[model samples]
Target: MAQTADDAKYLWQKKLDNGHIRIGFNDVAHQEIGEISFAKFPDNLTEVKLGDVILSIEGAKAVSEVHTPVAGKVAKVNVALKDHPEYLESSDEDKNWVVELF
Candidate 1:
């Protein structure tokens, strides 16, 4: 995966080998949100425009939305988050990733 910084604060974009885009939160975002308790993502959402809200995260301090930086079709999501929401607290790239868009 090739990673790039998005213009939006705390958002990172990763380019997958198959030319898809992966969206994730950076450490700064995790710090701002506090401990994450839950995450909600759109179900069966295929197409999305730039800046579309794809996921919502609830933390101890506040709720924040994760938006798409580029227009694309949803390919996959980190379903692990459904059972292990605390994974959002991780700053590790492999753990904090939220979704993949193709």
Candidate 2:
């Protein structure tokens, strides 16, 4: 089911690392959806607007579309998730980030 950005945690900014901004689902979203099993991220990107669907996540409970919490140029994507999506469940929130923005 599609819901407005207002009702979802969708995505959030993790602390700056080497100046790159990390983006991922907030704690509430991870807890609500359970363990993540798969993820799909954007390809050949330039920029993203606020609320843009940055990636799609499939969890133990349900599939969800995660949106960009802020607008910025796309730096790179976490391609590692394609094979080990379980990283999203890491105790370290930074490991769960799906996108990096500049």
Candidate 3:
């Protein structure tokens, strides 16, 4: 499916000042799954291959894996969900960046 302004299929990829690219799922991902409850990222420093399982999210009904479009080192993880997992509901991408690669 093509990514439209109303639908977010392709993640918004941006290069950070550090040279690593930051990526987050688009709104379509949230809309398809409904209110996301759980977001799981691969362990830090773990190598993730393209199309590999980067993160699996549990929505209202189904569980889906968020794929990694690129290959790199997992530099950081968003721990905000530990307290407010629902953040993924309000702000799907910015607050829900599953992991950052280095």
Candidate models: Cα lDDT each: 0.78, 0.74, 0.64
Q: In model 3, where is the ten-residue run with the lowest total lDDT?
A: 1-10
Tens digit of per-residue lDDT, candidate 2, span 1-102: 833333245556765847878886566776777898888776665698887877777888877777777778888788888898888777566577788888
Pick the winner on TM-score between candidates 2 and 3.
2
- Root-mean-square deviation per candidate: 5.9, 2.5, 5.2
TM match of model 2 to true structure: 0.80
Better of 1 and 3 by TM-score: 1
Q: TM-score, each model? A: 0.86, 0.80, 0.75
* Candidate achieving the largest TM-score: 1
Which ranges in model 3 have alpha carbons more than 4 Å from their true place? 1-10
Per-residue lDDT tens digits for candidate 3, residues 4-71, read 22213635666888987776766666667777677666565367776666666777755776677878
- Residue 81 lDDT, candidate 3, scale 0-100: 63
TM-score: model 3 vs. ground truth: 0.75
Better of 1 and 2 by lDDT: 1
Error of 1 at 60 (Å): 1.1
**Candidate 1 residue pairs that clash:** none
